[model samples]
Target chain A: MKEATTSKIAWGWLALAAVFLVYPLVFQSAFFRDIGVLLLLAAISASAWNIVGGYAGQVSVGHGMFFGVGAYVPLMVFTHLGWPPLLGVPIAIVVVLVLSVIVGMPTFRLQGHYFSMATLAVAELIRLLVGTWDFAGAAIGLSGPAIPRGWWDLTFTSELPYYYIFLGVLATLLLVTWQVQRSRFGYYMRAVKAGERAAKSLGVPVRRTKLFALMLSAAFTSIAGSLYAIKTGFVDPESGFGILVSVQMLIIAALGGAGTLIGPLIGAIILIPLQTATNTWFGGGGSGLTYILYGGIIVLLARFEPGGLVELWNTYAPRRWRSGSHAP
Target chain B: MLLEAKNVAKHFGEFRAVADANLTVAEGDVIGLIGPNGAGKSTFFNCLAGDTEPTAGTILFDGQDVTNASTETHARLGIGRTFQVPATFEDMTILENVMVGAFMRHPGRADARAHAEKIIEMTGLREHAHLRARSLGTPGRKRLEIARVLATGPRLMLLDEALAGLTPGELQQAITLVRRIHETGVTLVIVEHIMEVIMTLTARVLVFNQGHVIASGKPQDVVKDPLVIEAYLGHGHGKRARKRGPAA
Candidate 1:
């Protein structure tokens, strides 16, 4: 039965990849391409956050710490030493993986609101430190060195390249999340999230599972950050490590369905379009309306449908069509 | 001994909850643990299940020291238990709740599911297999709790008030099921306020009073002891106790 499910999922991905490959070719436009890239990046980041916040029931508002570090470390290294973004990305990932442990060791002990607040405080501290610290270009931020227009540089002259890169990254992250959801570690995480006491009673190594989730979540979010920096070609303390960035990631996870595999993608689908439409209509005043819209959606969803859009679909839709159809 | 607790004690602040308790259970033994409220029966059970660490003494399971082990470790070591209040995975189905226990022994979900089906059938919860555990009635939930623990392949089962709030018919069925479970060679330690169920199910009994064991012997003998009757009926009712039949 697992073999059947795996084969079915593989076929589903094959179908999705076919659509992803053909869509850009048929409807090529710079604006659409840019939106696609942003949506993909948001999906990747939200999915990464879901591993810990959604699946493991650990809400973290310090994801920007990893994102900021992921963006800056590679760009900073490249700016000073002339290394390529390709090499810098992996280096950034490794750095964040190490940083996750340092941060997680203290914060994971705290549960619920305390954990969320602690993570937010740590993220805020990082933002403040980045703004004031001289080594990280001190608030002014750092830009990557100039590179010729080439595939190897990961720098392109157009949105098309970024769209494809992000699409690939988004696909990879989604696949990773799916794999994790099916693994023994994923079961441990779910057990912990259900009830720490019960999971411990069942012999689940709760702390170890949480640490693993946090580290994996940080690693993926860091990769998204590195990619964001590369695509944008510039980064600042506010833009990279802002509290709003963390909130946005969490909102995406919440709106999509948190623990579900496709939740972040669903969240990105709704949020990115809404943000783009608001920006087009309201212009500079649109930012406030965007928050109002997001807040309203969150409140309405949380109040009426705490499980988010994925849960709503599961409740109403036919289960046979879904990718993963485990018994309740 | 299949499970043993040696001089176990627990304290909350300055108050002693369970003091210097010793217990032993061999394979296929059905031991009834009885006491009034605040006698530390629940606390003692918690210590044995590793939900709360004993401040002093040791626990041995299948010959290894498991004193400070987590509840999960105890579970994996075939020490399955049911909570007094039926603590289940509420969001999951009744079958899924059982599957979680089954998963303790079977790593694969398919195998766990197969095992859970059998347990659910045994508990007579086949009709409610897909229903959420929270939706079940009290007796149904108790049965689900029992099934959940039984799915874990436990050699020793700890049941806390498993028959606390059951209809007489349900109680009879539960007793029969417990006997059947014992017939499968699983040792049972039952903490029950229902004297009739305890008398019918247990071969031996241990009485607790004020956080101490006051009596231990065959159920018929232990219940007839003066201290056991006084503990149950209160000191003032000692003269009136003669009007009632023997304690058993």
Candidate 2:
């Protein structure tokens, strides 16, 4: 049974990769390409958030701390030392890994609402500190150095290249999330989330599992940040460290389904297009309209479909063709 | 000895919850621990199981000091325990809950599932194995809890009120299940309020009162002790004594 499920998942992943690789070629629209890039980035970031938020049941409101660091670190290194963005990307990931531990040590002690508040405060502190710092360009932010219009620097001249790059990152993140979900660590996290006392009684290391989730989540979000900086060629304290980034990640994860493997990906696919459409239609009122849409969806889903779209699909869809078949 | 606790004490704030509690169990031993509501039976079990740290004394498991190990560490060291109120992963199926424990001993999922299946059959949970654990009735949930702990492959088993909230038939079945568990060479330390269960299943009994061990010996001899009779059986035994004119 386990082997059958694994093979099914492998086939599902293969199908998804094929679609990702061929989508831009067949669609061939600049608007769709831009939307695709944003959706891919959102999916990657939300999937990263899912490790701690969805699996561990530790809602974080400050993932922007890791994301911003991921963006700023690479830009800082590349602009000051003339380092390649590729080299700087891994460095950003490592930095966020360390930062995750730092944040986790202090805030993991606070559960539920307190933990959420602590994360928000930490992100706010980072933003304030960056705004006052000299090297990080204070409130103004930094722009990328000129590259000879190539893929090496991650600074592409067209939307198609950025689209592929973000898609690749999204794919890597999906694979990572899948592997973590099957690993012992993932089981430990789920056990902890289910009930701390029961998990402890069963001999699960609660603190260690939570810290590991935070580290993995931070690392993944940081990589997304690095991509964001490269694609936009700009980073500032506000855009990089805003609360909306955190909220958007949570919304995407929740809108799809928390704890399910592909929920965040599906969430981004649905929400990002809706958000893009709203922004195009309403202009300056787009953000407000998007929030209302998100709120309405959440209310309706919470009232009528508490388990979210994944639950809905599982209820109605054919059993043999569903992704993430391990669920019982 | 499979498990031994020497002078284990636990204090919460200024109150001594468990004071100088001691017990010893060898392989295949089913020891019952009976006490009043506030007599610290749960605290003693918690301290022994490593769910809560003891303020003082030592716990020797399989002849090694494991006084302050974490619960997970204790589990890995071959100690499995169930809670008083049936703690299970509610969202997971009964088989999956057992498999989680089995996975601790066997890393391969297929092997773990096989082990869990065998335990499910033993516990009479085979029919309900695929059902969500929360969907089980009280007796069934208790059985699932026991099965889950048993799947961990523990040499020493600690059961906290595993027989609570069961019908008379269910209680009899649970006693039989405990006997069967002991037959597998696992040492058992059970905390139960049901005197019949203690009398039937336990070879030895430890009676607790006001956070102290009042008596320990063969279940038949110890339950008849004058001090245990006075502290636990209360005035009902006194009325019987009066009616019998002190020595018959």
Q: State the lDDT of candidate 1 residue by residue for B100-174, as single tens digits.
A: 677777878778788989999887999788777767888988888789788888888899998988888988998
- Tell me the interface RMSD of every candidate, in Å: 3.9, 3.5
TM-score of 2: 0.91
RMSD (Å) per prediction? 3.2, 3.0
List-wise, what DockQ does each model earn? 0.37, 0.43
lDDT by residue (tens digit), candidate 2, A1-328: 4467679877876897888788888878888888888989999999999999988988899999999998898889877887766677899888888888887887776555777888899999999999989898889998886764455777766789888878877877877787777666777787878787777767677888889998999999998888898888889997788888888898899878888778898899899998999999989956589668877887887788765688688667776655432243
| The best candidate in terms of DockQ | 2
Off by over 4 Å in 1: A1-19, A316-328, B93-96, B108-137, B242-248
* Candidate 2 local Cα displacement, residue B5, angstroms: 2.4
Winner by TM-score: 2
